[model samples]
Target: MQLALSTLGCPDWDLERILSVGRDAGYDGVDFRGYRDEIDVTRHPLFTDRADETRSRLESAGLSISALSSSITLCETDDRAAHVAEARRLVEVGDTFDVDRIRVFGGGDPEDRSRAELARAGGETMREILSIDGAENFQWVLEMHDAWTASDDCQQLLDELPADNVGVLWDAAHTIRLADETPRETLDALGDRIEYVHLKDAVYEPDHNDATDDGYVYAVPGEGDLPMADVVAALRERGYDGWLVFEHEKRWHPSIADPDVALPAFVEWFRDQR
Candidate 1:
């Protein structure tokens, strides 16, 4: 498996600077995010229809686009079409960059009504997305996030329509917040559907009203009292040899901490584990 850093660590830095930092720090790749303020789409071709340009920058930086930190969730009662459009744009960029995967979250829960209808609608959407030309160029892995992470929700989405491109991103923090099942239980349920993984540590802080208030709010890896080593061992036991995305929510926890400072420690932690 390879170690990578999310651009999320250096939210204040430009993508170029983050690229250089990751290379210098000996990270393998970066999780690409297209936040408007962080990386202006108007000025940067990485957000535009210029895949070659984005790929060239990363290649020059000695980094790979491990996954696109996309905001595509088929949920939200409104703006579903807009979300799909956004996803299409990202897919074009991913194809150009030859990115391995594009991160996504599956459909939302619309008040637990009409189970049949929800299933049908979800299947249709997945089919349309999977059938999209060139979507196969990059795998679409749905991070088990939001409230849709319950075993039934995940199983239903995978069961209703098992597309070749459909896979799960095993995010420990998100799963810890959203599921009653242990990581082992959830992964066993997901079985072969898991394709990507995100690694981070945070403590359940009730000081705030956000989700992190109830759980780890972007704490440094191994700092919080999470069984992260066990989680890693679990993934390894399952033969999950892939990227472990480190996410420091610099957007929300701007003053909390930064990834650049926490990364060297994380690399050491990883090395020690190995």
Candidate 2:
């Protein structure tokens, strides 16, 4: 699999720095989640008015825009129009950069309702977005996040909307940490629909003095408990040849290591596996 780094890790870096550092760090592509503290790339001038320049710069550097990680959530029943508009804007930006996979979330708060109910709503919402003209060229990837971390719940949504372009964005950290699923179990249920993968690691610390409310904290790729080797091997066994994106979420967790340290470390670790 090819290696990519998300701009979410380098929240302070501009477009120029993203391209330069990504190429220098030996990343094959960059996932555009945010840049220079701006989470909405559609509003960022680099993707709006300077989109051509952005594309040319990446091409010149021999790198690719792997995917555009959007904050769009489909599980919420309210604000349907707003969500669809946001997805369209992301689709436009992604098309400009030749990115085929756009990451969205199933924002089902399980505390409020059942996973099945949320999946039904999310499936309808995903279908609406996929029905748009020209949307067939892109895959709307619903990540294993929030209430959808459970592989079976993800399968429910997939069953509801049987579309070729609809797929899953496998987040290894969430499946293992939140859903208590082994990599093998997750792949067995959703591997056929996994269009992209988010690679992150964390140590479970339910009783640790310093732990996130989720009872875990992000760790560098190889330094934590995630089954990275097994996940990669499973993908290979399935003939999956997509990008393994290092989703170092320093943008949200400021205490984590900077992209300068995290980015190169991922490259080295991924290369070692090869």
lDDT for model 2: 0.84
List runs of model 2 lying over 4 Å from the truth.
205-210
Model 2 Cα lDDT, one tens digit per residue, 1-274:
8889998789988778888888998989999887785887888898989999888999998899888888888888887788899888887887788788888888867788787888788878888988777777898888998777889877877777646888899998888878988888888888888989998877776676545678876777788777887788888888889989999988877877778888899888887776
| Top model number, lDDT | 2
For every model shown, the clashing-pair count is 3, 0
lDDT at position 121, candidate 1? 62
TM-score of 2: 0.94
* Model 1 accuracy (lDDT, Cα): 0.69
Q: What is the TM-score of each candidate against the true structure?
A: 0.87, 0.94
Give the per-residue Cα lDDT of candidate 2 at 187. Answer: 86
Off by over 4 Å in 1: 35-44, 49-53, 110-116, 208-215
Q: Go through the candidates in order and give each one's C-alpha lDDT.
A: 0.69, 0.84
Cα misplacement distance, residue 208 of candidate 2 (Å): 7.2
